[model samples]
Target: MRLALVLGEVAQGLRRNLSMVVSVVLVTFISLTFVGTAILLQFQINQMKGYWYERSQVAVYLCTSFDGGPCEEQAATQSQIDAVENELSGATLAPYIEQVEFETREQAYQNVLEQWEGTAIAELASPEILPESFRVKLVDPNQAEIVIDQISGMPGVFEVKDARAFLEPIFTMINTLSLSAVGIAALMLIAAALLISTTIRLSAFSRRREISIMRLVGASNRFIETPFILEGVFAALIGSALAGVALIALTEFFVGGYLAGEITTIGFVGTSDALVVAPMLLGLGAVLAALSAAVAIRRYLKA
Candidate 1:
């Protein structure tokens, strides 16, 4: 049968170039793993942004002992606090602020105690030393700088800190890592493509006599090309399958088991995320291999 002969040719090509096939498989595996890591990191970042940013608040720390900005080495008075409250509620900055919660010194101190519970640090905290502050939630989290600028020089205010500022550096680091992974994946894929092209060319060269005889008998281009294309697809599929396994293990053991245990604050990608990415990796590998084989055959193994 035509299908059987094509499969036979594919098997022969693979057996003849087993080393190159294995190399293609390994390269595709590593490259796709990097690609999957980048995607999962992006997903994790989006999840964190949705969870943290929605609850993010701008903390306006009132002066306890005013050393510099809007403070005179004295505790903030009730009138100054009330003035801040009025400003926050009035028309000028009201459009930016969603709501505000005032925390008293005792409450702030209690929060510190709770945070430092059972630690030696708790003993150093005192309610009198803790500055009373206002927690301001913004209508748009991106508008945090606007709130910070408005409240920074105001009386009774020590400094305005946006909760998002604390998170930006961390997120920025994650994004950089994701981009790095993408860059690495791209380089590996290029290597895989070149390796595939070389393998197909070698296979075609080895079978040149057969190809010549078939061309003399008027064999169609599709019939001649199918075996080589299938060989590349077979090698790539193996690599892609290995990559999928590695991705699943990574998500399960590293992200789910290790990271989730260490940082219980945020949810991480799991096996399901790997499953979502696995099929895409397989498809990408197959497509890359097929295209590379076709190009190599057309250019170097022409009938």
Candidate 2:
């Protein structure tokens, strides 16, 4: 009987403030969608790091005739190459170095040709311009900096390059994008909270006379507040449901259909990831709405 009365009151408040309820729903939906998207993006970022870090190797480039610095415009001699190779096999670097593949200038030139076959770019490349470099595959990619530091000043070394140097910029951009989405979601959630508070205040005002009669009949504040709080929760829950649907669709169409086709090297957030994020969004929406409504109603009742 108590549940029925609260339900009726909740229904009445929703019906009376239908426009405001809809506004709250839409706002919550959009905000939570951004939240879910940010989470999925972070998950994708982690996946990319795991996938790329394993395959990434540190390239210890040897000096060519065109190189400056220690090379002084002279090509690396056989003695210099032997000195660098000695360091790789030595105790100082042996444990860190999994395997070293030496690429001669001729091999590098051929690789260029194979990459750009039938193109003028391939014809313009020459073995003289290419450096004979040692590709050091580390047992642990995290120790790349250590390897780079030790080999950087060695003879015949022009530059110690890591694949991370190329990939860090891309990761930074994606991380910035994820943070931006979180920022936008925060602002939109604030807007939704304010809308919910206003809706509760207006509902309380419209039914002030009935509330006074209920209080006179020995009604408790808890009984009066329950309906208002439930009203907000219902609206936010609907919004959360919509946000979940949008996330699933995005993962399916945008990730599975588009990104999977465009980028074959890395895996992406799938429907299961979306499913994991959906519950978080729903809980966040409900909690935010309930708190906003409770505070708004309590203040109005006191006034």
Best by TM-score: 2
- What does candidate 2's lDDT look like per residue over 9-117, in tens digits? 9999999999999999999999999999999999999999998998899998988889999888888889989999999889999999899999998999999999899
Q: Give lDDT: candidate 1, residue 2.
A: 92
Query: Each model's TM-score?
Result: 0.91, 0.94
Per-model lDDT? 0.90, 0.94
TM-score of candidate 2 on Cα atoms, chains taken together: 0.94
Q: Alpha-carbon error at 150 in model 2, in Å? A: 1.9
Ten contiguous residues minimizing lDDT sum, candidate 1: 65-74
Report the lDDT tens digits of candidate 1 across residue range 77-168. Answer: 89989988888888988999999999999999899899899888789888888899999998998888887887788878888898988998
Once superposed on the true structure, which residue ranges of model 2 sit more than 4 Å away at CA?
110-124
Task: At residue 177, give the lDDT of candidate 2.
Answer: 98
| lDDT for predicted candidate 1 compared with the true structure | 0.90
